[model samples]
Target chain A: MTTYSLPLSKRKRAVKTRPPRDALFIAAACALGLIVLVAVAAAVIPFAGDPARIVGPRLSPPSAAYPFGTDALGRSVLARLLEGTRTTLVLSTLAVVCTAVISVILGLVAGYAGGWAREVIMRLSDVLYSFPSIVLAILIAAVVGPGQAAVLSSIVLVTVPLMTRMVSAAAMSVAKRDFVTTAKISGVSAPVILFRHLLPNVSGTIAVQGTYALSVGILVEGGLSFLGYGVQPPRSSLGLLIQEGGSYMLQAPWLLFAPAAVLVVAILSINLIGDTMRDRLDPRETRSLV
Target chain B: MMSASHPDTDTAPVLELREVSVAFTSGAGAKRRTVRAMNAVTLEVAPGETLGLVGESGSGKTTTASVALGLKRPDSGEVLLLGEPFTRSRRANAGKLQAVLQHPHWSLNPRRKVGESVREPLTVARRDLSRSEQRQRVTEMLEQVGLNPAFAERYPHELSGGQRQRVSVARALVTEPRFIVFDEAVSALDVAVQMQILALIRELQAEHRFGALFISHDLGAVERVADRVAVLFRGDLVETASTEEFFRNPQHPYSQTLLEAL
Candidate 1:
C-alpha cells in the first residue's frame, strides 16, 4: 500500500489572506446599536425626561437648554425623539420577531414537506404579495383601528410574505441536498429534520432578510402612524411626531427634521447592515468582499 | 475475507429488491411525459456481501440505489430489509438501512460538527444508549474511518474532500446498519483517496458484516471492492455475475463495452 502525492500545482493550498475590513458595516452597526441603546435607556430609566411634558415656549427653535427645541405642543423635541425611538423600535422589533418566527416555520414546512403543503403556503403568500404592501398595511391597520396592535399586525402582515419567500427558497435548496435525505434515512423525526438540519442551513438567509424586514417594518409603522392608524396621540411614535411636525414645517423645520433625521439614520443603518450581512453570509459574495 | 462463492442460504438476505419499478412524471396536461426510471429491476444482497452496481450515466443506477435506500418509493414491487418489508413510511426500520452518497460535501450538514452528524443515527435509532455512550461510539467510528477523534469537533468545511468522505462513512456506519448503499461514494475523490476509501469500506464491511450495494461507473473501482457485479443499461438490469467471472468473460455486450472503455 503506497501513497501517491500530487504535484505542487495540483495540490490545494489554503489562501490565508485576511478579509478586508468594511468601514460602512462597522459604522452602520454602531449607529444601529446606539439607537437601540437610547431606546432601551429611555424605556428603563425613569428620569429620562417626559417626552409628553410641556417644556419651554411652543415652537421654539434649537436653544442651549433644548437641543432639538420645542414642538407645536411645547414638548422637548429631543425628548420626544428619544421616546419615539423607543416606541418605533419596540413595535418594529416585535413585528420583525413575529415575522421571523412565523415565516421560518411556514417556510421550512412548505419547502421540506413540498407537494400540497408547498402549494398552499406559497399560493397564500402569493395572494398577499399581489397587493401593494403599503395599501395592504393601511387596510389592515384601518380595519384593526389605530393603536400599537394595529401597527404591529400591519407590519407583520406586510413583511411576512417576503421573509417567508426568502426562507422558503433557501430551505427548498437545503432540503434537496443529500444531508437532509441522510437525516431522513437515519430516521430522525420530521420536526428534528426541520429544526436541526433545515433551519440552520437557511438561518443566514433569515438573518439577512430579517434586517430588511426590520427596516421595512419601521417604514410601515411610520406610514401607518403618519396616516393616523398607528400609535395614537399623547404617546409619540416617530411617524406620529413627523406627522405633527409636518404642519409646522415652515415655521420650525427642526420639529420635522429631528424625528425625520432619526428615522432616516435608523433605516439607513439597518439597510447597510442587511447589505453587509448578505455579502458575508453568501459564499459567492464573500470572495468579492475580501 | 468472504469468498465470492460463500453462500448464506441458511439466512435471509440483508436486502432484497423484488421487481422494483419507478416512473417519474414531469410537465402537465397534454404535454406531460412519464419517464420509466426503473423497470421492475430485481436484485438481492446476502448478508455481508458487496454487490457492485455498474452503469453509465442515466442508466438508473441512482434510481436503483434510491429505491434500495427507501428514498424513492418504487411504483410497484417491494423492498425487504432483514426479511421485513421496508417502505418510505416505515420509521421502525430507520437505522437498519443507510447510504453513502457521491458528494461528501452534500452528504453531511455543513453547520454540524462531525461528531454530532455521526452521533445522530445512534441518538435517533438506538435511544437505549446513553449520551456518553453515543459520544464514545462516534469517537470509535471516526477512528474506524481513519479519522482522528479530534476531527469530530470540526465542521465539514474544515476537512478535505477525502476527509469529508471519511466522515460521511463514519456517519453512515455509526448505527451498525443491517444494509448500506454506497452510491458512487468514491467517485468524487482523487485516485489515491479513492483506493484508500475503497480499502476502508472493505475493511469495515469485514468487521461489521453489513451488506452493501456499491454503485459506481468506475469498473476498476467496482472490481476492487465488489464481490459480485451487476450491470444496468437504460433502466434495465442487463447482467449479474461473480466479480471474477464477469471481468474474465462478460456475457452482455454492454458489460464487454464497459470493460473495453476501462
Candidate 2:
C-alpha cells in the first residue's frame, strides 16, 4: 500500500480480518448457515420420499439408494433426517428470539430505574433463576401438552431470566455514565435516552449473549424432544431422531447416528460464531485487531 | 503570575455555596465506610469574575463543582446561583449554570457527531432554532473556541485532546449560560495546550462576562486568571481571600504551606 492509501488500507483490512483469522468463527458461521438453510428448505419444499414411509427393506445398511438406511419403523431415515432439520431450526430459533425480546426489555427497565424497582426486579430474576431450566421446561410442557409450541414456549420461559439479568447489568453500568446525565440535563426524554444513547452503547454486550442463547436453545430443544415432551409424533426433530435412534443401536446405528452427528455439528458451529461475535463486537477488541 | 492580573477587584458575588457538604457510603454490607468529599465548605464566585478553587489530589474540588452544577445534591447546605436557592427545587433554572468536565476523551460521547453535541442544550430548552440558525450558532461557537466549522461533523476520537476540550467549551458556551463550573477541564491536556485553553477561557469569560468557578491545583496558574482564590485542605475551606491578598499575606498555616509547596 502507498503512503496515501495506508490508512484506508488498514481500515479495509480491519473490516475483513485486521487481526489474524479465527478458524473457529469461520467454521461456526458456515455450519450455522448450512443448518439454517436446511431448516428453511424443509419448510418450503415437500419431500418426494415420505419421512414417515415404511417402504425400504428393514435393517438395510448404508448403500447408494439408502444413505442413512431404515429405522425400526421401516421409514427412510434420510427422508426423516431432512424433515427433522426443519423442526430443529424452527423450535430453537423461535425459543431464542422470544426469550431475548422479553429479557432485553426487563433488563433495560430494571437497570435504568434502580432503587426499589431494581431490587424488586432483580429479586424476581433471582427467584426464577433458582430452578434448573430443563426441569422447568418439562413442567411447563406437561401443563401445555406435548408439541412443538409447548416445547419452544417452555424453553423461552426458562431462558429469558438469564438474558434479562445480563441486559440489566450492562444497562445499569451505562446508565451511571456522565453522558447519560448530560443527556438528562439536556432534557431528552427517558425513552429517547434509553433507546438512542444507552442501547447503542450496550449492543456489543447483547450480541455476544444472544449467540450463546442460540447454542443452548438447540440443546434444550433436543433434551425436551428426547424425553417425549418435545416435537411429538409425525413431526420430526433432531431430538426425536435421537430418541428413535436409541432403540435399535446394535441393529442399525445410522438412523440415530446421522441426526446426532448433525446436532453436534450444529451446536459447535453456533458456539464458535457466538465467541467470534463477542470478540468482534467489543470495542476493546479493536486494539489487538489493529 | 500575580494576583493583580485581574483588574475587577470589586465585582459582586454571582454564585455561592453556604457550608455545602457532600457525603456518600462506599462498599456494601458491613465493609462500608462513610466517605465525605466536601465538608461544610463555604465559597463564592463573583459575577464576570473567576474564583479559583485550588486543592491537592482528593481535596474534593470536583465534588464542590458537581454540587454547584445541580448534578449531585449535597447532604446538607445550599447552592445559590444569582441569589436564588439552587437545589432540587430550582432544577429548571439550573440550565442558567453548566459545566466543563475533566478528561476530554470521556467528556464528550464519541458515538455522536459534534453538531448534535453542540446543539444539544439549546434543542433541549425547546429553542425553535431552524437548521440554518443552529448551523450558524455551532459554527460561531466552534470558531470562538479556535476550531474550524468543518470539525463539527467529526467524532470526538478523531480530534486531539486540545480539540476535544475546545468542543466541550463550545458545548458549554452554546447553552449561553451565565455561570460555568470548570471541573479540571484542562488538566488532561499538554502544558502548551493548557496555556492555550486557559488564555481562551480568559478571553471568552471577559467577552461573555460569565462567572466561572475555576478548579485547579496550580496556584501559579490560578494567580494569572482568578479574581479571588479559595484554598481547600482536607475537605475544609482553609482560606478564602481576594487573589492578591491570599498570595501576598496568607493568614492560615495550611494556606501558607500550600503556597510554599508550590
Candidate 3:
C-alpha cells in the first residue's frame, strides 16, 4: 500500500485532539450529584419532616412558614421536594441507563453482523416502536404493578426501540468505513473489529442518545408519578409533589411552581448537554456552523 | 522442501491468471445490474520479474490484483501462484501472497504505531518471531524503503503520503510474501514520492527476489519498473508484452490512445 507520512509538524497531531472534557458532562454530572445528595438527605436527614417529617396544617401556604408550602398533611414542602428529587433521580437514571445499555448493545451486534441477524433484530425494534410511548410504558406499569419497577420498565420498553435503531445505524456506518475494512484484512477477529473499530468510532451516537433517553425517562417517569402510578407515596417525587400542589392551585401555587421549575431545569440542562455533546463530537457540526 | 532460488524458477511462472474475469454489480435494490469489470483475461509473471497491470479505473486493474492475492473471487477464472492455483494452495499459504493498495491514508489502522502495522503480516501468519526479531525486521524494512527507521514509533497519520505508503510496503514485505499485488499503489502519491516508492519496490524486489503484479493507471511508471506490461481496457486484455514493445508497437486502439495521453 502506498503510504504518506505527515511531516514531523503535521504528523505529530493529525489525530484531532479530543475536545476537552465536555462542559455538558460536567453540568450533567453536577446535576446528578445534587439529585443524589438530596435523595440521601431525604432518606437519612435525621429530621421528622424530611418527607418523613410532617408538620403544619395539611395545606399551609408558602412563607417563612413553609418555603414550598405544606401538603395536605402540613408536611414541609421543601422536605417533599428533597425526597421527590431523590426518587426522580433514582428511577429516571436507572430507566435511562438500562434502555441505553440494552439498546446500544443489541444495535451494535445486529448492525455490525448484519444480514439475517440485522433483519430479525431491526424488525423486532420496529414492532416495539409501533406502540405509543406513554401507552407502552403504562401497559408494562400495569402488569409490573404501579411502583418504581413498573414505571422504570415501562419507560425502558418505550425508549429502547428508538435507541436500538439509532445505535444500529451508527454502528453500521462505522463498521463499513475503509478503516474497518483494513482492520478486517489485517486478520483481526470479528469481535475485536466490532469493539475496537465499530464501537469506538460510533461512541458519539451513544453519548448523544444516552442524554436523550435520560431526559425522556425523567419526563416520562415524572408524568407517571404525577398520575399516582409511579414511585409510590411516602417515596415522594417531583411528579407526585406537582400532582399534590396542582390540586390546591389557588392557595399555594408555589407548591406546583417549585416542582415544575425543577423538572424544566433538569430536562433543559440534560437536553442542552446532549446537544452540545453532539456538536462537539461531530466535526460535521463545526463544518456546518462555519 | 520449499524451493529457495531453485533452478526451475525460470520455468514456472511465480504468479499466473488463467482466463480471469471480474464482474461487478452496480445500481441498487431492484435496479441492480452486473457489468463485466474484467473480461476473459490471462497473464503470468516469472519469479523476480515485475509484471505491470495497467488500466483505467473500472478496467479491472485493481480487481486483477485482488483475485491474484485471493482478496476477491473471479466468476470463472483461475488464480495460480507458484505454479499451483490459489484454490489448490492451502489457505494458510496466504503468507506467500500480499497486496499493497493505493490509498495509503486508509490502509493502516490509524491507532497503531508504524512498527505494529508493519509487523501485522507476520502477526497474521502466526509467526513465532521474537519481539526483537520483529522489531528488527520492521526497522530494516523501513530503512530499506528509504524511510527513517525512527518512524517505527510513529502513527500512520504522522507520516507524509509517501512515508505512509512506504510503511505499508514494509508491512507487506515483512513476511516475505513471494507474490505481491500493487493495486494502483503509487497513483495517489505525489510525483516525487511516486518515483521513490517505485524505486523502492524495484529495490525490494531485487533483494527479496519476489514476483510482483504492479497495478497502475500510469504508463510512465510502468515503463520505469515493470519488466512486462499488460494493458486492460473495459476488463479485456488489450495488449501484453515487454514494457518496451508495448510502448513502441501499440496494438490496441485504447492502448494507442492511452500511450499518446501519457
Candidate 4:
C-alpha cells in the first residue's frame, strides 16, 4: 500500500524557497492601484494636459518635456495613455456590472428551478456560448453600430454566457446541498430559499467570475476599438492609441509600447487577484496539506 | 425492558407509509436499468412512539425516510401525515413534518447562525408570532437540547460535532413538529455522544409527545430508543416486533444475522 507522506523538513524548505502566495497577491494589488491612481490623476488634474491637443512635434522620441514622446498627431502620448486607461477601466467596469446582474439572476433561476425553465434558459445561453467570444462581440458591435454604447453592449453580450454558466453551475451544486432542502422542509418560500440560502453560498463564485469577466470585458473593448467599431476617434482608448501607434511603429514605438504595457499589467493584476480570492474564499482549498 | 406506557393506539397514526415503493431508473436506451429502492414497505408511528427501522446500507432505509419526509414521490403506495394524504398540499405538512439528518453540517447551513436555523421553522409555520417571541422560543429550544441559549449566536462550524447534533435536534423540535424523522441521526456521533443524543431524543419525545421514525443500522442505538423495531433486508421488510421481543426472539434469518453482528 502506498501511504503518501512528506517529511516536515522538506515541506518547510519548499515553502522557504518561494515567496508566500500573499506577497504575489499584494504586488498585483499594488500594480493595479498605481494604474487607477494615474487614471484618476489624468481625469481630475489639469496639469496632465489635454490628450487630444497637439503639444509636441509628431513622432518625437521620449524627451524630458514629453515623457512618452508624441503620437502621429503631435499629441502627448503620456496624456493620451492616461486618458485611455480611464476610459477602458470605466467601460469595462460598467459592462461587468451589467453582466453580473443578468447572469446571476439567470443562473440562479436555471439551477434552482431545474425543469423546463432550466432547459430554456440553459439552451439560450448555450447558443450564445457556441460562437467565439471575439467573433460574437464583433457581430453585436456591427449590429449596434460604432460608439461607446456599441462597445459596452458587445462586452456584455460576449461575457454574459460564460458568467451565467459559471453561476448556474455554482448554484446547482449549492442547491443540492441539504440546507436548501432543509429550508424547503421548513416552509420557507421559494424566493426566500433562492435569495437567502442559495445566493450567499454562490457569492464566492460570483466574485471570482466577476473579476475574470472584467478582464475579458477590457480585452473586448480594446479589440472593438482597434477595429474602429468602438469609442471612435478623438476619444482616446488604449486600443485606439495602439492602432494609431501601429502606423508609426518604426519611427516611434513608444505610443504602442506605453498603452500595451499598461493594459497587460492591469489584466494580469485582476487575474492574480481573482485566483487569490478563489483560494481564500473556498473552504475546501484552505484545508491543511496532508 | 420495554417501558410500561404504550403509544396511544386509539388516535390516528401521526405518520404512515402504506405499501410505499420507490424505484430509480438510470441511463437510457439499451443501457437503461431500474433499481428497486423500496418494495411496498409499510410502517407507522403513533403519537409519542418511536419506530426503529434497521437495515444495512442500500437496503432502502433512506428511501423510506425520503418518502415519509415527502422529499421523494413514491412510484406506488401512499403516505399520510397526521392521517391526511401527504401529497394533497405540501404546505399543510411543512413544519408538522421535519427531519434531523446524519451529518449536522449537511442539514445546518454553515453560513447561518444556530438561532436562525432553529427559528426558521417557526418563522414559516407560526407567522402570527412576533419576532421576539420566535427568538424566545429558539432560546428555549436551544436550552432544552442542553446547550446554552447564547450558543444560538454562533455558527455551526464554531460548535463541536456533538453540539452541532444538539443544534440539529433543536432545529427539528423548534416547530413542535408532530412527526420528526431521525435518519441515522446518532450514527455519525461518537459512542458516548450517541448515548447523550439518544437520551435527549427520548426526553424531548416524551415531553412533546411527537412521533418518530428512528432509522439506523446500529442495533444498539435502535434498542436504546425505539419502542418497536422493524428490520429491512434487500428492500424487503423482514420482521418487526416490540423492542424486547425483537431483541429476544428475532423471527427472520436476516434479523438474527443483524443481532449477531451487534
Best by DockQ: 1
Task: Rate residue B189 of model 2 by lDDT.
Answer: 84
Candidate 3 per-residue lDDT, tens place, B1-262, comes to 1235444436678888889888888899999999897798989988888998888877877667767766577899788778776553233564677767777666666656878777766666646777788788888888878888899898776788888888878887777777777877888888988998999999888778778888888898889889999988888998888888988998889989999999
> Candidate 2 lDDT, tens digit per residue, B115-230?
77877776665367787787788898899999999998997778898998898888887766678878777777898998899999999897777799988887877887788899
lDDT of 2 by residue, A1-290 (tens): 00011244565566676554487678778887887776577557745277877867886887777777887767788778888877887777788888778877788888888888888888888877888878888888899988887778877877777778888887886676556666665556677778876677667767777767777787888889999999987878899899988888887889779999989999888777777776677433432211
lDDT per residue as tens, model 1, A1-290: 01112322332222224344489889999998998898778778834478878978999999888888998888888888888888999999999999999999999999899999999999999989888988998899779887999999989998889988888887887787788888888888999999999888887888999999999999998998999999998999999999999999899999899789889999999999998787667422332111
Candidate 1: segments with Cα more than 4 A from true spot: A1-21, A45-48, A283-290, B1-10
Give chain B TM-scores in order: 0.94, 0.88, 0.91, 0.94
Is candidate 2 or 3 superior in lDDT? 2
Query: For model 4, how many clashes?
Result: 0
**Which lDDT tens digits does candidate 1 get at residues B113-189?**
88999999988888999999999999989998999999999988788989999998988888888789998899978
Report lDDT per candidate.
Answer: 0.86, 0.77, 0.76, 0.85
Name the candidate that leads on lDDT: 1
Indicate whether candidate 1 or candidate 4 has the larger DockQ. 1
- Give the per-residue Cα lDDT of candidate 3 at B236: 94
lDDT: worst 10-residue window of model 4 chain B: B1-10
Stretches of candidate 2 above 4 Å error? Answer: A1-21, A47-60, A283-290, B1-14, B26-32, B86-91
Backbone clashes, each candidate: 0, 0, 23, 0
